[model samples]
Target: METFNLFHDATDVGPDGSEPEGYLCRAARLGPKLGASRLGMSVYDLPPGEAICPYHFEWTDEEWLVVVTGRPTLRTPEGEHRLEPGDVACFPAGPDGAHYVRNDDEAPARVAMVSTKNEFGIAEYPDSDKVGVWAGDAHYMLRRSGHLDYWEGER
Candidate 1:
């Protein structure tokens, strides 16, 4: 078994420029390292003014967050709020679970995001008016306004 410490363990991933500037973070992908399947977990060291991801919700996967270090701000439908160390929050699947997390404090923040992984899933991003589709191997990010009738493309 592999032992990983949130406070002292070295992170395996860092700023890669793959994500937008404000969404970047140095992360330790714990799930794969610890042989976790079905469920996914990652510990992120978030820089001040940075975020974990956009405000969105999954169609069927539930997510949980655990704050380990500096205070980070959480934004849900209710509005933005600061979270403290040891704080845990659950985001059920769907619109009611829509949320976003950011390191609003002057110092860096650390948080763990644990979520159930579904082979097929859909996520909606309300802020950007976009939708993400994820299947076993296929993925897509599309605009919410680009909708068409169900039969529009049928012969």
Candidate 2:
């Protein structure tokens, strides 16, 4: 029986400093640390005027987020909404579920994100015209317009 606390966990910072291109803010990957296999979970601490991740949606996995503390703005396909502590948001698989969390308030915001872990998944970034393909432990990102013909160089 192993137990842990989200608040006491060390913050995981990105290699590129604050406001990384793809994913910004500091987070704690609690899922794998807690031995979770079917689900992915992370605790994020987002600073003011920064987004946790880019605006994107998964093609095969569903994701949900809980506002743990402070007010964070949720950007969705509809529009942006302010989220309060304990507020929950669900993003279904596909373009309709595209979302991004931004801390627009004066203070930092804490959020917990949980998602269905699929062996294979594709994610699209509508704002960046890029796509991410994930297969097992391997992942790749490519621009939407960078596709090549299947038989382009087969001969």
Candidate 3:
């Protein structure tokens, strides 16, 4: 039998010292390492002013976030709230689940996000007006403003 600790075990998953600070976070994807197929868990160590992602929602999966250390700010459709260690929140699939997490304090904080996995997934960024789709191996990120007609290019 194999076991992993949510607060300790993790593999690289984010930030990568990129120019876009909006998605910068010391994150690790643990699902793959633990042989997870239908579910996934991502752990993130967020520094001040860093966010996991822009406010978004999933169309096919439900997620839950657990604060492991320090306090992080969570933004949802309702409003922004500070989450302390041991705090947990559930985000159901759809618009009501739209959310964003960031560290607004002087110190760093850790958080774990667990969600259902799907063969294909669709996510939308309301703040950026973009949509993200993933299937097997191909993934696409596009702006919703670029609307296409049903037969725009079809003959």
Highest TM-score, which number?
1
**Winning model by lDDT:** 1
User: What is candidate 1's lDDT per residue for 19-101, written digit by digit as tens?
Assistant: 98899898999888989889988999999999988999988799999999999999999999999999999999999999999
Error of 3 at 41 (Å): 0.2
TM per candidate comes to 0.95, 0.88, 0.92
- Per-residue CA lDDT of model 2 for 85-134, tens digit only, reads 98999999998999999898999888988999978999999999999999
TM-score ranking of the models: 1, 3, 2
Single out the weakest 10-residue window by summed lDDT for candidate 1.
3-12
Q: Give the higher-TM-score candidate: 2 or 3.
A: 3
Candidates by lDDT, descending order = 1, 3, 2
Per-residue error (Å), model 1, residue 134? 1.1
Give the alpha-carbon lDDT of every model. 0.92, 0.86, 0.89
Query: In terms of TM-score, how similar is model 1 to the real structure?
Result: 0.95
- Model 2 has an lDDT value of 0.86
Candidate 2: worst 10 consecutive residues by lDDT? 13-22
